[model samples]
Target: MTTAVISDSSSLIMVGKLKRLDLLANLFQQIVIPHRVATEIQAKEDGVASLILAHPLVSIAATTRHELLALLDGTLGHGEAEAIALADEHQMILLVDEKKARKAAKNMGLKIIGLLGVLLLNHRRTHITGQDAILMLEQVKAMGFRVSARLESDFMTRLHNPITHWHSPNTLK
Candidate 1:
């Protein structure tokens, strides 16, 4: 069975910076984003805004879980809360980058993945070479994305050894 994925804004922006947002579309059969997330990306002028707005594989989903969104208020951004709520409603995996958002998603019993996880999946699936993944990782760091030291070490190890390392959302920090 295919894993469902709902994306928050950060991951899309990062990948769009690399001009490879298409990878997400290729890696996941479909990616859903809450309207708030789309708005967030637009507000930032992220390059992925066009892709999210126009891509056939991307869906702009509206979150119906207002109560859940209110419950998660302050702990997460509107985009994060809505993404989590949408994922919860559909039993899908969530793609979020912020540490707090990931923590909240984990606590809420949601399956989560981040940018690194997507890269790893692409590498394991042979969609991208190890070198490409490492390059993207470096770009992400350079873009000010906070990857924990442990995750950096793990990614380097995987790049060098071609061994897969699974990232638990908790271990991301």
Candidate 2:
């Protein structure tokens, strides 16, 4: 896969779960964060920012005014806007979780995926086991990330095997 530039909120959420970061860093060629996103993270004084900065696969890039405005006009919120802008300017995939922002990105023909999507991809790639994927999802939830019931169900189905009962919703739940 090509490099993906994540905006602040998603990166913070991802890095907060160290295991998720380990998986992502291994999956992608590179992970870039806009300078604005980095600045926001730096202000938090949490390990997320430091971890991202220190990661060999991750880097920061400054965003321009034009790109910022375009993002603002897009469906992205302030933080996500900067991320999308950076991704668009660099022709990289934008890793975002906001609904409106995702819709806007799709409208603009930009490749986008949310936190759940990333986790699912990791699970599919065998970077994380099905159980670990569920654990990561729970961790993100504890950190205040939202996951819709439908999305959760869909992901669980992907992790299930038709010939076995290991991942049946009743058993997993």
Candidate 3:
């Protein structure tokens, strides 16, 4: 089973874009977020927060001060660092949307994935079509999440010419 531990930013990104969460839940065997991440989402009072709180597959894990301290020296932000630490300590994949957090996780030899990566995985798994993934990306954009031009171009290309094989590096890129 694939286990993922996500930071607050990624959690908010998923919650803010509700459709993506369904796709992620379908793709991963287990989804976990730090308790702080959950609390932040709840404070936002968005539909994404309520949906995650009610989801059967999502789990909320608490953070330890020790783990947080370990990540303090990394390039990740407070929430993201804590999330990466938890994932690394527990031997789970870290789902982070922040570029610095992703890089920090990579430098630390921790597995990572992002919101866009999860959507691509859903498309590759046939859980959602390429067109559907594009539509969801639009939804995420509408929710005010930042997306890069390169990602937009790549997503359009994928939508236009859907890949036949479901390779990890390709789907997650």
Model 1 agreement with the true structure over 1-173: per-residue lDDT tens digits: 24457999889888878888766875678888899998898887555688667777778898788899899876788899999999888888889989888888888888887888788777777789888998998997899888898878877786666555565643321
Cα TM-score of candidate 1: 0.89
What TM-score goes with each of the models?
0.89, 0.81, 0.80
Candidate 3 contains a number of clashing pairs equal to: 0
lDDT tens digits, residue span 19-116, model 2: 45766664578877777677777777656677777878778876675755574855556666777677667766777777777766666667776666
lDDT of 3 by residue, 9-46 (tens): 55445545564456666756667777666766776655
Highest lDDT: which candidate? Answer: 1
- Candidate 3: pairs in clash: none
Root-mean-square deviation of candidate 3: 3.2
Error of 2 at 137 (Å): 0.5
Those runs of model 1 whose alpha carbons end farther than 4 Å from true positions after fitting are 1-3, 161-163, 167-173
State, as a TM-score between 0 and 1, how close model 2 is to the true structure: 0.81
Backbone clash numbers for all candidates listed:
0, 0, 0
